[model samples]
Target: MNDVNVYTVTRLTRDIRLVLEDTFQAVWVEGEVSNFTVSSAGHTYFSLKDESSLLNCVMFRGNSGRVGFTVKDGMQVLCYGRVSVYDKRGQYQLYATKMEPRGKGALQLAFEQLKEKLYKEGLFDEANKKPLPFLPMHLGVITSATGAAVRDILKVARRRFTNIKISIYPVRVQGDEAKHEIARAIEELNEYNRHIAETGGEYPVDVIIVGRGGGSLEDLWPFNEEIVAREIYASEIPVVSAVGHEIDYTISDFVADLRAPTPSAAAELVIPLKHDLTVRINEYRDRLYLSIKTKTEMLEKAVKTSRDRYVLRAPMNVFLQMRQQVDDLLRTAVSGISHSLELKQRDLGTVTGKLQALSPLAVLERGYSITFKDGRIVRDAGLLEEGDILHSRLSLGRVTSRVEHVG
Candidate 1:
């Protein structure tokens, strides 16, 4: 019994864990995901199951943060990790380092997920979009300076509008550092514009064009990043996204104020053709000149007609005619005054008759005599005192009498 090898539970578990981890380092496992959950600490725990068996898996936050897409139950996935055992449970599980969807690429899945997310958040609403200027004085461009995109833009700009001021902010359009660089470029350009505004400097950037030449999804991943999308959304200056060919669409395109199919198209959109502007201006000038000429010709005709008339060609005849008009007006005014005076006299006669009918003298003529004292009509006889001189008014004349009794 003493010669027999002895193994404790801890020793057995530790030996198994080391063996599994060593042999299964960086093994690739493909299966349908189930029982997936993300812990509060951001670690992901899930089970990968086949038709016959199930394997437990855990992705720490460090590795899970790098995953581009959401993982859920019932979704087929491919996981790369090393097998390890938990000492507490004595169970073997996979410690995943990387994960990807089986059918779609990681970046593509990530893009779709982020688009849905931002759309739900109202970031992609048309109401939030800024309007591009009709004619921008200065333009800001963010792209690879040495790439074909810059060349295409410059070529279009030269042909379309040569006087527009353009400032280029060179940045990488791919790789790990590309997104950061692109975001920083947008921010710096905005800051520069702000500085120009505060200082009232000339040629401040009116609009920005963020773009790149056509490339694979992998190459264009930088523009698809959420950071780039947010930066484009936050930009005060209107942003025109011109990434890749017409077929390509990135997150930046969705968030930008406008999206052009290519960099050349972006240039054509922002810069109007000088020749076309000149043609329009010439049309306007011609129309204005024609209008003025018509007005002048009308005025000249009016003046010539005035000169040909008797007024300007014969001054004495015009004066004689004016004198005759004045004499006619004077006669008309005299006739009007005589007719008005006759009408007023007739009206006055009628008014006098009406006033005479309403007068107290009319009552006196009807045999009613009014008594007056001290020039006022005596309405009450009790107001008269003895020996008071009362003037009794009759229809013909006034009689002066003395008050003898209070009757």
Candidate 2:
């Protein structure tokens, strides 16, 4: 005789799940997200895979709803969860409690994801970008006051154009709050422009330069933020993005109306050299004078040539010819008027004969008298009543009578 013990498949799966849950109560796993989907119940399901292995994961609505951004397929992510086996399906999955992006920093991943999103939305289209002015009279700058970017920009601007007026809006260049400051600065500058336009104020800002000195990626992160990009895109004034060095590109550069290699480059591009502009203006003035002189000479030559012609040589002959033409036109006009009057007189005579044939005075002259009551002709003698007053209009005048008998 022998004693034997066996467990059902469900019991075995339950035991495995309990062991997994106990060992991996809270652990972090890194892999790329695949087959990501959200159910109608607000739960997320996906597979975490790397080159070596794959792990199925489920994030409930309570945790998934807290994720700051959308979960897309093929996104590398770090998952924090407990591992357990599903008894019904006989499979294991990571019951993820929280998840963050992997490979790239969370903020950076968010920036990249947002960049692709906005780019698809046509925010980075060349047609939507505004052109920079050739020479901006009033420039608004937004950056840190003590930074090298501002100093370089100011120095370059002063050197390039001595008369350029700059209004600097000092803000934090790098920090958690830097993006907010930059966004508000852009919005405020545009609003100030609108206010100036409404109030008819002088020296309104025409262009805006928003950036900071070169720094590390962390130092330049504010410009990569979505809020800063949105603000730069929404600025009514043209914006020149000069964040970091030429090699260092940010989201601001892609969304801005213009991108300068450096802060000094932005300044140099905004205005032309005073001496160069002066020379150009002088050259234009000289060309204008030459053109006018040549035209005037040609006109004078034409006038001289015309004076040598027969019409201008003897102006009295031209005057006599014009007078004869005018006399002919007047005679023609008088003849036309006389003919029109004769036709109108004949039509009037015909109309008068017709009118005389239908005149009420002609009927009265024929010995017929019109009797009226209340200014209406009395043709029906039966309609008349005794004692009613009647008016009999004869050929000479009207006679009033009172009807004494209806007969």
Provide the TM-score for each candidate, comma-separated: 0.81, 0.60
For each candidate, what is the lDDT? 0.93, 0.91
Candidate 2, residue 92: Cα displacement in angstroms equals: 16
What lDDT score is found at residue 204 in candidate 2? 81
Candidate 2 C-alpha RMSD relative to the actual structure: 12.7
| Candidates' RMSD to native | 4.9, 12.7
Lowest summed lDDT across 10 adjacent residues in model 1 is found at: 304-313
Q: Which segments of model 2 are wrong by more than 4 Å?
A: 1-75, 79-100, 105-108, 303-407
Per-residue C-alpha lDDT of model 1 across residues 129-208, encoded as one tens digit per residue: 99888888898999999999999999998998899999999999889899999999999989988898899988878999
Clashing pairs for model 1 are none
Instruction: Point to the candidate with the largest lDDT.
Output: 1
